[model samples]
Target: MIVNLSKVISELESGSRPKGGVKDGVGSIASLGAEHLESNGGFNFKKVKYVPDEFFRSQSKGIIRSNDILIVKDGATTAKVSFVDDNFPFKEASINEHLFRIKVNTELAIPKFVFWYLFSNYGKDQVLSDFRGATVGGISRAFVDKTQIPLYSLNEQKRMVKLLDRADAFRQKRKQAIDLLDEYLKSVFLEMFGNISFNPHGFNIGKIADLVSEVKYGTSAPAIEKGKYPYLRMNNITYSGEMDISNLKYIDLAEKDEGKYLAREGDLLFNRTNSKELVGKTAVYNFTIPMAIAGYLIRVRTNEKALPEYISGYLNSLHGKQTLMAMCKSIIGMANINAKELQSIKILMPPVNLQEEYSKKIKKVHNLKQKMLNQSEELDNQFQALMQKLFS
Candidate 1:
């Protein structure tokens, strides 16, 4: 048998309206945002924002409870979903206007089972069909209530939930393992170079311009949906200087533009303009495929004095991060450090041979890291495939 969405569940709620704005400050209640929802099964509390305590106290509803389902009701991330696990500790938290807090009727259906179903293609297709917004898409409670869902007996739902939970746990384990390897790389760096922040070993400090041969900004070329060269943007690089090509965009850069804008191996890409917290995030381009950097990124080609690998590692280190943050200048709302300013930043330059040796060691560790990352990606892909199959 099948039922409409509202028929199968208990509650549908949009969270507290912001009194003034959602800006962070000392607040009585912790508030949830769309950012807190993970593509995976958990919340990243570090990303959780806040709501005024008085506002939360006045609300008759919208208080988040454990076991309630959550969805991003508006914005480009519309249709994303999560189920509040019993293990979730924060019971006082409420959602922002951009989310819908759902409480499934537990007696009729398992919330966990329904949560996974929403992430499936069937659920997404329904959501896409009901999408209502001109600028940023949003879903109304009325739209969600009208959609139909497949029904299963309680025992079957429990069984399916168990299987999916196991798969999810396995995928999470793989991710955690990769994170450990990344930490190990940082540990090794500190052991060899001893935190570049204070130059604990008393190495000679040199200007960034003295170590790098050339520094250039990427083109402002307009990008098409599909193109020849992969376009590297700020979001493609992680804070730790690793390249995440998952959401890479492409551009049809002209032939003449390629020679100027195309980035090669060993090039360090710096995020020159972004939120202050994300400003100066760096990534080393190691992919052999031809790729072009976007206008917001500055490409730094290191010379013999500073090995590309060593400098990338150094710049992403804690000391490097502190130094970069200090050098940042806010323009409009975006944080930026121009090429000339970037070139003037101080760096601890070890002997060329020593830096090269450290680079070799870093390469070996990265080789291991890539292997684990590959496995993690494969596991996620397989699990995703299974999820699609169940609701195909």
Candidate 2:
């Protein structure tokens, strides 16, 4: 049966149970300073404060406790929510003006169950829809407290919590498996191609321009109606050089234009523009799609002399990133390393046979990545189903 949060608050206050403050506790998110808290994925505590005191001078920063629900109320991250773990560092840490910390008397509503409710489609819609702002959006405390919450008996709450706990466990294991895959790849690369500084016999260090044909960016395509032309952006590149297709968009390109932007099999895609840390990230375009790269990406194709896989593995390596960073020149808060700059960068040359051997190992790792990714997707689907069952 459907339930209203306001009614629950009222009922709790009338008899054996009593509800706390209902008034919105925070102000516009613009008030918070750059300092903020960080949440650890697999840790004893859920939140760690990075926000400074200067940021909270005027706002009535709300307290967070174990099982307290935290909803991000502003900016692009709106509606993102986290539950305060029992071991969270700050039981009384004041949430910044941009976040709303919510709690109900434990007698009336189980906090974890409430967390599951807020995590569901109904909860997400309520939180995100409450956001009000033109440029940088925000959600009000009043909106959160008044948002309806489903009520279940204490026993039912316990059951749902147990189910969710198990589901989350599976999710974390899959994530760890992905992380292990990355670590294994790095180990493989190091074993095959010794660290740049370490040359047992003798090694050749040369400028990168000597190894490859050219580095070039894809031309911009005018936005197209939803269709099949695969359009990829820099954000799609993962740390392990995999493409995330969840938010993948397509551009309708004329046949003539297709040749210019379409990504070829084995073509290496590098992020040419983004925040300092994000720029220089790369992924190999493994899928054979009539795809066009976005303006922010650069495609590096090799000549007969240099193998594409050789450069791809090198670029994804630590040494490749350091070289790219050295060539980066910042402009107006954004850093860019042009094709010329990238080409001029230096790398240690491994023999063609050795390069091909490393490439085979990398391909094996990529295959493992695809398998783990498929498993992750399956776990995600199961979790989503559980969420719907717990809420509905």
* Alpha-carbon RMSD, each predicted model: 2.2, 7.1
Tens-digit per-residue lDDT, 241-353, candidate 1: 78899998889887877878999988988899998878998877898887999999999999888887777777787788888888899988899989998898877888888
lDDT of 2 by residue, 332-372 (tens): 87888777776776666778788788778878887888888
- Compared with the true structure, all predictions reach lDDT values of 0.83, 0.66
For residue 6, what is the lDDT in candidate 1? 80
TM-score of each: 0.92, 0.81
Clash count of each predicted structure: 0, 2
Number of the top-ranking candidate, with TM-score as the measure:
1
Give candidate 1's total backbone clashes.
0
Best by lDDT: 1
**Window of ten residues with lowest summed lDDT in model 1:** 17-26
Candidate 1 lDDT at 259 equals 77
lDDT of 2 at 357: 80
